[model samples]
Target: MRDTTADGAADTTADETADRAGLRGDCENCFGLCCVALPFARSADFAIDKPAGKACPNLGEDHRCGIHARLRQKGFTGCTVYDCFGAGQKVSQLTFGGRDRRTASREDARRMTDVFPVVRQLHELLWYLTEALTLPAARPIHGDLGRALETTEALTRLDPDDLAALDVPAHRQNVNVLLLKTSELARAGIGGRKKERRGADLMGARLKGADLRGANLRGAYLIAADLTGADLRGADLIGADLRDTDLTDADLTDALFLTQPQLNAARGSTGTRLPESVTRPVHWTPRL
Candidate 1:
């Protein structure tokens, strides 16, 4: 693609940076694919309404953003922060054969779009696990990380048809055990693995550095625990009341169902890592 922007030199420089670091969601190679494929509602986050697999009005047929420079003014701040962790490009080029889902057969398009999010999720796990493998603090799980990387890579390489059939959540559950151990080893230097607020009714415990790895926190009423520094690496929070647990520094990165609001509410510093699909919570504002 020719440089259409004013500073053609700047575009080439950016292309070099992107190629070296692996493509981020903002890369031009993506063809603004996510904007067109995903659904959104008319609200504070989205200025206009859109449905799944439908093209966004601001998307140009040339795979460019019509409101690229003024997305914030247009109420697309959500799109600004969205990242596919390299999965978007992979789906566009590899899984879907370098073509947009909209151009594919209806059945193929539906299947591809529906499965993209799921694979994006798995790739997300891969991203986190790959990062975790690099942490010296997680040395105890280095071997496991290597193995996990291989397994997740194998899964990522599967054909979209086969990938769509996968039970990812179940696979995630199996992977969680190893991730739990990595968390445990990393946090052990801070404290032992046990967090007990037994009957304290910690609706939202903020124990980011309070190590709870390997702790049997079963059935604990931590509906919304603010476990910021608390380490829950391998702690069995199974059946625990974590409906809205704040896991900012809690290191539930490898823990189970620690999904969404539960993952978003907690305080965490930059060192506090998590899955790719999920991002660091913007609210906590930790400096650590």
Candidate 2:
């Protein structure tokens, strides 16, 4: 049997599982978009220089990376960690239906590039929503997550021209409302004084600046949720899905089992601080 279980992201670690589900880079089916569409500077993360919208210098004519297998040794770990969340396959097979970008008209190519970001953003949201539904605690937000997920999915199915015209940021602004609601439900699961948050579906809640010190937050669905400025000192964070969850400005000085990537992803406000072993994630606004 295939286990016949609901091992969606909320229940399982969407980090590892989603990566293995053929969601990561499989360039054979792609046009090397990440290599070209994304910009890279000469740094420890990237060995050679590459500009946005230009093909990578190492990109092979056959739409492959010259050093595909040795990307890590060549300092492309960021490239390796990136997951299109199924967008690469969708764009390759459906959006353009395996049409080669090389033959595309210059204007069409630019339009295609424009739409790639839109689809990419939508797929990322899919990954999060799919992961959220796996939580037994998040059942309360199931209706909201389902509706928003469908909306996001519909956007992903748009054709190149339609996708190019999409205002993804504005759509994100609207979806963030539901995501924020989902976050509140999920974070509420982190056992608090009220006790109603216990076993709550908090897969991706935004608990920024919330007080959760000494709270029982075990087995919470915390994958990728933002916890900026949240007080979590001595909070029971064991078994919580912390993958990619942002803790920026959050105080976790004595938090238990708050893993590296999870702790690293967090953005701490003035009130939010962490233990010495943990480091801040790459993304965050520390102006506060």
Among the numbered candidates, top TM-score falls to 1
lDDT of 2 by residue, 1-288 (tens): 001124322223334354335433456688877766777888766787877788888888888879867876888755644556556767877788777578777876676567676787787666555544544555666666666777788888888888988888898778766655555555555555632244556867877778886666656777668776678875656446665566666678756435444443333444457654344544445645
lDDT of each model, Cα atoms only?
0.60, 0.63
For model 1 the TM-score comes to: 0.61
Segments of candidate 2 deviating more than 4 angstroms: 1-24, 192-288
Candidate 1 deviant stretches above 4 angstroms = 1-20, 191-288
Residue 60 of model 2 has an lDDT of: 80
TM-score of each prediction: 0.61, 0.60
lDDT of 2 at 209: 78
The residue-by-residue lDDT of candidate 1 on 1-288, one tens digit each, is: 112233211122224232324324535666565776678888765788888777788988887888978886889765654566676777777777776655777887776666677767776676556545544566555666666656776887788789888899988877777666665564455445355433456675555467666565645777566666676654544336654455544565544323333344334567666644355655455655
How much is 180 displaced in model 1, in angstroms? 2.0
Worst 10 residues of 2 by lDDT: 1-10
